[model samples]
Target: MKLTKEIQDSIPFQYANDVRSGKITTGKYIKLAVDRFFQWIDSAEKDGYHIDHNSGMHVIEFFEFFLKHTKGPLANEPVILSPYQQFTFYNIFAWKDENGNRRINHVYEKVARKNGKTAGLAGLGLYCQSFDDEEGAEIYAAATKEMQAKVCWEQAHDFVFKGIGLRKIGFKNTQREIRFEHRERNGNVRKGNFRFLGGDSKTQDGLNPSLAIIDEYHAHKDDGVKEVLESAMGARQNPITYVITTAGFNTTSVCKAAEDVYKDILDGHKIDNHTFIMIHDLDEGDDWEDPANWVKANPNLNVSVSMKYLKREYTKAINQPSKIPNFKTKHLNMWVDAAETRIEDHIWMKSDKKIKLANFIKNGCAGALDMSSTTDLSSLGLVSNPDENGIIDILPLLFCPSDTIDKRSKEDKVPYRFWKDLKLKDYIDFEGTDFSEDNFWEKLPVLIATHGNQIDYATIEDYLQKLEAIFLPKWWEYDRWSATQLVQNMTEKEIEMHPFSQTISHFSEPTKQFEKHAYAAEFRHGGHPILRWMMSGVQAYEDPNENIRYVKNRSTKRIDGIIMTIMALAGTITPEEDNNESKYNHEEFTL
Candidate 1:
């Protein structure tokens, strides 16, 4: 029951202990993987499952014993699993069901670029084909293209050399297949086969796979190949779908979709006890420049992945903006587009300007409305103190249809699932009727009040009614397309509505001011995750006149919240535009 010094050195055990003891730096999903793993281990006895330590150790030790390191400084030496690698191996092979089937039926790992994934997966493929107890095991290395699929297959093929895992192995080099004569304890012999399957193959039938290793899942446009190959597993009593790759650029890729679902499982939004997930990457708050953060994603940092080479590349990336995206993607394991990005994450994370609605309600503030077309998002952006100090605080309320959360989340890759309220986090599902004139006035304020059951609806309405009693604005602004019933209602209240055209001439100056205020400590957003994501996704172009305009490109994120904030800031900067004298009257208001 106790871990000896030798056992304590195991990558899987060490990582499990480090995560349980809170000793290692990790991200949101990494924490989920570690916690869920231990939870499974603790509940195994009660679930009629058994922990086969020998079976798990057999995998890790097998890889270390016979797998040769192919193309590194340690080339030709046996492949020794790092702590993170050992953790993965331990999870996939250690637990067995009541009928002695492997508990982990599938594993999807979103790891950094160079942690020896190809070599490791090749070793596992060889083990499944030649060493596992199963008779006639079929293993495959699959990908979208034939050339891409052959990389892992070639690695597995190279392992057929003498002294490798499956010593005296038979390799049909022309056909790209490896066969082993596995002997049973009863002196009966069976043929275990491993081969490469290209995505160009017409049909994926006739494969009774025990293990399918999918490499570079991010490169695949969809999960077509994975689905077809996984479909071949029904006949096998114990089968596994293994996916391994780095972060991808295209948000619509199946890897991206699966990545989100895995995060959901990690965060306890859903449960999938059979699949093992681990995302090796730096946590959100960790400084990417720090060498220590490199180890967060690259578990093999100093070993197979050189610290000196990474430091050199990091220095270059810091100095050259063009190289930064690729460096972050490959080394730091962060998902970033190589295209132009406007709002910097480091700047947004440092902002500290979130104010309570009650405090802002006491003071008067101007509001801007952006009700995107009927099928999209509707948002209200509030900016306080337009005249004297110029936007002392900000209050944003975002609304989306209850039905389109998943569609929007997938399309933009933003965490809309977390922005359902006026809070700076995720979203709340809106269940009311369409955002009509009557509905907007009624539903918008309630979303803010009901978050975490902090305040009731009537109380928040009562507080806002007091604000309406003394509501005045230096100016109220809105995008032209948002001339809704709500816009008419606010105008009828005599708070002048300025229909600002979204043009370079009109918004160029305020947009620049907004950027300046953020970096110069003049403006602050409450460090909302969705806001940060929107800021990073903004695609802007600068004209020859030194003015800027936002242009939508092929990026995989939405900028709705940031757009609303900009509209709010537009009114805040034009303080002298108040034309109505009776705007400051204690206006009667009701929901």
Candidate 2:
């Protein structure tokens, strides 16, 4: 392929080529992203996009020539971008559409700690405020707390005082903000401001931003800052929201949700043409102990992040197992929970087989309902009797309020609505059965959104009656605390409801069995994404008596599906002394 001068000179392009040619090592997702970049470049013209080499180069020049380092040994020195840093800036500024407008309006960047993420992005923020030529431009560095919000802003704030060129512009450096005074062509004075916006700030009204840099987004408990910044950018011609962060412990955070979206774009699952994503994380099964693999996450490995420093951290993590999760999260750029997870991702993924649920209809199943929170996700998990191969198939039906799906989607960063639209056929097999011939069980929705803000108990009762008539589940288990009313209503409908105690002793055996089935690949979950995500968040908590119960790493994380699955598994565990292994009756059931 013929390469333009811009492509040939681009550090990111070279990095991509090297990664593709095996000259450099990286995670599969990073490799996939770079590959996508090259593919897009090759077909960009036909796709109504163009690479404005000069525009990207101009931004790079501003960084190297104007910005100066404010701290460490490089204090007062001109900012020199590492190859990966250059790649980041080039991609963001280079991509353009048919109208010569910036193609990328948003960018999500994930890098390991000590990679100069704040400093580099701070320079970009300053550039957007001054050089972007937007009238009365507003630039914000936002975070959940005031201290965190000031981190990036301080870096940019210091650059103005240190950089001679920026200093000459007479920037008003206040205690909380920096401003550039200017007048329009009509002789009207306008002041462009750059400020740090904390979540507790008084008000964000009447604000119009040209660039909003969200730093350390993973630490955010909610989407308040992000939501405000995004909604305020509607009036700008080419506004950009730059989210930059390292890996964090909270799997249920808004940052992790944003990561999922960027990941989908990289994986070719979904498309958002205006968003640019570059993530650096350890690949699946990558040995974090290996120094050779460290560069995959820390792209500026030997530059901004020293090998000696990382080695010291790794050694500490090795000697003290408690520090391992922190090392992985901060140094290796992996989103690990502070507590160790019960099931490894590889082990859990092994049960993702396409088993036909319709074929097991005559085989009686057991169910468990988890309605722990009326305002959050509720699940009804069904488990079939072990087949001749000792494999148990699972079907989990999830529910949430219709009115809160979108709200929760934005707040929790999970796609509740998308999951609700998914059907059984999307994940499991439905062939060679009467149920497959029509839009019945085969097309049964996996997640249903009930009307209103609170879960409608009547809707759950109706569904239970339908399931009992069709599948004839032997019994249904319910949590004693939250399901008393539901159980009472179901009992009136002739459905056997058992109160399941939510205790360590009660859950231990079934939890152990669930793990056993998972490890042996005897549990078929059909690779449901929601279940997989919940499984990822699960951590085993052990009592002093050696009894164990399922718990989520974070309180905000929803593991109702996993809990219900464990409860349902209890009913399928037949005693060894009972020679009659067939738990289900041969009699057919009718709806």
Candidate 3:
């Protein structure tokens, strides 16, 4: 634990100790940051922070004041950095704090395309806009389009007009911004700016930035502009959020749910020391025509990349299989399994038709529960809306309490008493509940009761009186956890429930609205076998941005009746259908 002559002349800390001692050919989170950076440099006094070699040699002397080739054969020279960009500027300016602050405040550097990562995170957003001592430092580069947020804001405006004290920079470019003013050590003077935002921008809340270069975050399709730039970074301090990217085929992005939480914190199964992942792909089933697995995802191979332009695009993607998913998702960063599924069990067994619930008497349904965890198994799901042959039906019931339906039908071997009806302390089939243990049913005062693996409000007011005697439900969305007698009987029968919360900001738009009407076949269901084995045990997991959730993976399986049929098809579908109030007439009935 003695290393410091600039981290022993770092080359990204000797290529993260030669990719953690195998002599390099990377991946596996740079060998899990070389065993979590020498157990964080041998427990910097039991992990509270230390190493600040003058904020890591003032970001390696501000990248030696620029110039090492803005273009061809070394255009001005000085630059010199490439041991993984001096190991990401010595692990992001040598992790400080103890009044020095900056303890890696979020950075997700996925690599690949000419791996300099948009000119080194646009030169760390121009050193957090004029030297990291943030004071009015709102710096951005974020993108979704404004031509991908002006590719790292025109390379941090050509490295602040080609270097040298940022070319005597006084700031102020205005016309889309680039400002500067800084001056601090207490004499005070703030103004830092440097902008460019756009996940279809409009309002990203009152931002406080202090450095936010998200550039190409997998062309974001929701994480609501990284949740308003992380809730406008609570008026800044240690605010970073960097996210630089490359591998993107949109596997329900938020950059593929933060690349599955940076591959579960590089497989030690998650710890997150303020998120600093460096995922340079290519490992799983390597040999992408092996040039040592293409330097295990080009960490600036031959600096600014060129093994003769990746062997001429790996010989035109080994003979054009449609250019092998854009050269394995842009110069091999990877995730190209772009099949982002929702249903395909033969179109979900061709929406297994069999409809019944006395065929919708009062009309228009919606009710999607989803409880589980008292011995697991709770779902009620309903959804009817699109009928004039537009199909759209779906039922699913499930429950399971008659003493854990014979131990979850021999531990989920399936047949749970044929979608068992309802019976908590024992049995009361949706209606007549004398609950008998003697007098007012052992004071259980039964109404939707079950208090162990939760679900009470006993068969929801007898399934809302047999679903309003079939069809009559404009709402009832449930999912967050229930049983306070179903929110006190849906607030005493004025029933219009709602609750939803299953995060990824409210189940990522009803999971892409139940994957777009179940891939447009519209949706109808009944052959039930525990809702077709919980829709072939769905796996969805995205959430670093455009939410997808359906949790419990690695095959523990039980998609709570497909999450109460996508929370009753996200309040019974609506992409604009007021063809005079989206249907249901029963002679203008008054119930």
Candidate 4:
């Protein structure tokens, strides 16, 4: 397609073609030239003057005005323009079909920061509001916040009020909408009004937008907001949806979604039905210090941005390496790691410890149980016996309730089912063989009587009482072994003496509180490797202060494992006590 005189004059067309043809080696230079040209167009248009070839605003204004009026009758499709619109229109809107059907296109762009994104988009807004073919066209420039929305609105407002020829076109900016009235051959008519709508589903709903621009689209907290805006576009035939933003924090975010769509277009994952342009710094490695990487990532250098500003930021970032990622990605318009490490290696290493599974099993075990109410996992902590030397062993068990079962029932896994699946029932040996599955209640008294002297069972109730009486105040003072042992004792079957209700009500608060304190304190202390591991594996949703009220956040496998170990220690304690008692009885008789 032959370039129009106006297009040839616009710097974007020249730089874009140069970049496409490999003549322009620097992406930043091309971006700057393009952005500068667009800014000039915006300035001229705002002043109510026509941008001719010599003026450099001609091509920019022409592309913007073309998009506004290109949709003949099907103007409501969410239309997005790409590669700053002018470069993309050659393939999409510049030519007429043999059948005379003008190709309608949707455009999307992913560009880095500080390269005239707002300015270029504002120019488009001006053209759409002033010269678009649709009369009374409802145009919207949206962002996550009202302030962001206003930024676009203000730009458009300035262009309409200040652009050279736009004033004569009767462009008027009201409090909320920009309106223009003009005379056609048929009759006097009014057209080109744009409204600013902040990014929210409820705010954009029910509006028939002829054109919509989603600025910084990735920063939106929820995808639903974007979806709502897209849904609103269905009312406009051949409507344009312009998604322009930089990379987001993670691949899961909105920016990544748009990036993926762009990639799919490039990779033939989808038909190239829409116009997509992705101009990003191609810096590949972790090395941000390399000037080569900087050049690759920032394509707006020396034009819109001064080299001095880049050097200053680079020096500042280098002085504090911690700020490199943010500076490189946000300011330099590069893709870098946005998710900072939540756990430092040194902190984790300082708290790490190793123990053999055999040794863990040999120790008298106590359990800490974290039950769940959702499909989230239940956790168990099995604390090892404290030897005469005051050492504690700990093991963790996790049980994740099945999502399907929980979802279908709207209930957590049945306790009996969990016990059966984990073989916990087998590990928990009842003293009597006469125990009945259905009538376990009838045999419970006998089992309790037989094991009464052998085991110490504490229900959740016993655990809480012990916490309030002995654990809370001394929690931090306890060594790793003592803390683990304490938690184990609380989980024992012998402590299970209950009107089960008594245990449930009393254990609820304090137990939760202890868990919370213990979890955070252990996290802070950076010791108690086993406790740290258990805590790391714990997915509890207890308040920061309470552990007993904690609900499991993930699968219960780890905590449940820990709880079983604790239970083992509690149940086995009786044997040791009984042996000691027998020895004393024999000595007394002999005496």
Per lDDT, the best of the predicted structures is: 2
lDDT of 1 by residue, 195-248 (tens): 777677666778888999887787777788898888888888889999987775
Sort the predicted structures by TM-score, highest score first.
2, 1, 4, 3
Query: On residues 213-297, what C-alpha lDDT tens digit does candidate 2 reach at each position?
Result: 9887777888899889999999898999998888877687788988998899899999887888889988888888999889989
lDDT of each: 0.67, 0.79, 0.65, 0.46
How far does residue 516 in candidate 1 sit from its true spot (Å)? 30
TM-scores vs. true structure, each candidate:
0.56, 0.58, 0.35, 0.49
Query: How far is 324's C-alpha from truth in model 3 (Å)?
Result: 20
lDDT of 4 by residue, 1-591 (tens): 224676665554675656656665545433443443344345543433332332234335454443231223424222233333445433333322344322334566665565556666776666656555566677788777665677777877766654545667677889888887787788868676787776532455567777788777656766655566677776554466777776544446666766666556554566543353545545344355666555444455554455677778778666544345546555655554333422224443432343223333444343344443333444434444454444444433343433333332234333423332332122222233322252422322100111122222233234344323321211111112323444455436233211111122223333333333232322122133233333344332211111122222343323333333333333233233322121112322221
In the predicted model 1, the residue pairs found to clash are 11-83, 418-426, 418-427, 419-426, 419-427, 420-426, 420-427, 420-428, 469-586
Q: Give candidate 4's error at residue 12 in angstroms.
A: 5.0
RMSD of each: 17.9, 17.3, 20.5, 17.6
Residue ranges of candidate 2 with Cα displaced over 4 Å: 1-3, 182-191, 339-591
Evaluation by lDDT, superior candidate among 2 and 4: 2
Residue 332 lDDT, candidate 4, scale 0-100: 52
